[model samples]
Target: MKRTFLLFTMLTTPSVSLADNAVNVVSWGGAYSQAQDDAFNTAFEAQTGISVNMVDADDPAVPLQAQILAGNVTTDVASLGYSDATRLCDENMLMLIDPATLRPAPDGTAAVDDFLPGGLSDCFVATDVYSTIIAYDESKFPENPPDSLADFFDTEGYPGRRGVLKEPRFTLEMALMADGVPAAQVYEILSTPEGLDRAFAKLDTIKDDAIFWEAGAQPPQLLVDGEVVMTQAYNGRIFNAAVDDGKPLKVIWDGQIYEMDGWVIPKDAPNPDDALAYVTFSTDAQALADFAMQISYGPPRKSAASLVGNYKDTDIPMTPNLPTTAQNMANALAFDNDFWVDNLAQLNERFAAWLAS
Candidate 1:
């Protein structure tokens, strides 16, 4: 397996003791990392005096797993997708988190009740909800745009290469959705062999015209470079490309799949106490809302939802762009982390085989 090197550091305060005054945190880079740094790390340092060394990765799970197996746990706390957190916890690769340690909502609600359903796990505490949505270059489809998952798969009508992430997770979910499977029944249908075949069969429609992207940055770039007319992308990345970079892009919220990203500590972290403190502070309602103000991600706390109204430096309402918003949630799939945890290895094996065939 290839390892992602996290090559960055933050030395805001000049006095940090290597022995007990520092903890390392890892996250995916780009605008999302900037949001976390602004929302959590700096304030965390100010409150606790534990200097945070910020590390960046394509996917934090990759290097985190490497550190766990190699027995040199340099990352004190790392942000992870729910499935990775659950799977790693099952394998004893992550430290089990106790929700009791977390600070309650400002209204005096308990941590467990304050977080979104399924947001708390044995080893991780959720930070935000982000989605993988279909986006197309608006310049390519000014008159007739891709409005649905079916449009995304209809290359004959849309008439260009489609960009998809090079992974089984969302690709399989999307193929199933495009095949007319209801969002509520995706996992139920995927559990059967016939269903898996059906999803693969649906994917075969655009297989020849699809360009697979391995990184989050590639999808919007593909759209911008005119390499693809439509692609699956993280909403924040596409939003930044459109608003910040001035790329003409349109997002299709139909059949979007949303999942949680959260904080988890390694079982043998050097600074476990500081790691817990940071996560507890970072996931509180205000802090999560503060994160949304910097990026388009949806804060997972119900209280935080009300606090998200406008993006920083722009008058754009962050609500409509969020995956958890009422409008977007109508036809969305709340990613079944448990389903993926149980079937990922098997499905991934089949997906790899099918790809090579």
Candidate 2:
């Protein structure tokens, strides 16, 4: 376990006066919105003497794209999907913050090592880990539940209308898994032309059973309304919805497609140094844990998982209780940013054709 020494000077430099200059941050609004606003922003102001001007965006990509195209970067830091981060990096719109400068080490190894493998990019660093899984109404399937991706596609066995996202990433992966590829082999199969076609063909089998979801919040509602018996959903969103509505919903973690979201600084941000400090502060163990506990997103930092006690006793074993410990987070699949960046336009075209066909 590696730990970086906190840079005391960065907190005390006279020139870098911690005035109430509001650092801007943009994120998806919902439970995550309120959690970040109440927990992270409040603690940040107390510790750094810098206030935050928080902006909540329902569709983060549109506003972020608009800001970048208009040459006006309003947000100092933005929480974006891995695909979105890759797009921003390609567009030359992100600023890089040296990990060492963010938190100095006495021996001077980059603080990047403390992060999970594939969590850090040149311009972005992962902040949270989430999963897209099959969530079902437990009351309906009281005798037995679909436990894996294969079971999800077994319309005769499960016998209910299913909900799948309108996007390709998880849908393609789930299709491959149902077609009998192991979880680890999902992307490898999809990487090849034959495998990609096979996955799509398998998906076509259940196309009639699926009600495609367009928004993050919609899947849970569909589940609650009995529009679909089981649906693919973000684990945090589903968990929060279940808790709120007292719905007898349970997430099937087997064959779940996990994703990471991160904080990115714009290339020409006005307060680069302050931005680095803010990023570091946000990733600190306690703040990270509080953020995760308040909302259900898992923490990307190893230390952050230890700080949150509630996770240890959750319905699903908290990260620390698993076979792959938080420290060895390298095992998780790195979402293939390059593939998505290169193929999204073409893939979207093909997907539209498939959906209509």
**Clashing pairs in model 2, backbone N/Cα/C closer than 3 A:** 94-267, 95-266, 95-267
Model 2 weakest lDDT span, ten residues long: 1-10
Q: TM-score of model 2 relative to the true fold?
A: 0.82
Put down candidate 2 lDDT per residue, 221-286, tens digits, no spaces. Answer: 898899999888878777777765677888776676667787888765556666777888887656
Clashes of each: 0, 3
C-alpha positional error of residue 245 in candidate 2 after TM-score superposition, expressed in Å: 1.7
TM-score between candidate 1 and the true structure:
0.85
Q: After superposition, how far is residue 341 of candidate 1 from its true place, in Å?
A: 4.6
Each prediction's Cα RMSD? 5.0, 7.5
lDDT value, candidate 2, whole model? 0.70
Candidate 1 whole-model C-alpha lDDT, 0 to 1: 0.85
TM-score versus the correct structure, for each prediction: 0.85, 0.82
Model 1 residue 122 lDDT? Answer: 97
Per-residue lDDT of model 1, residues 18-107, tens digit only: 458677888888777878888887788787777777788767888888777777777888999898898889899988888888888888
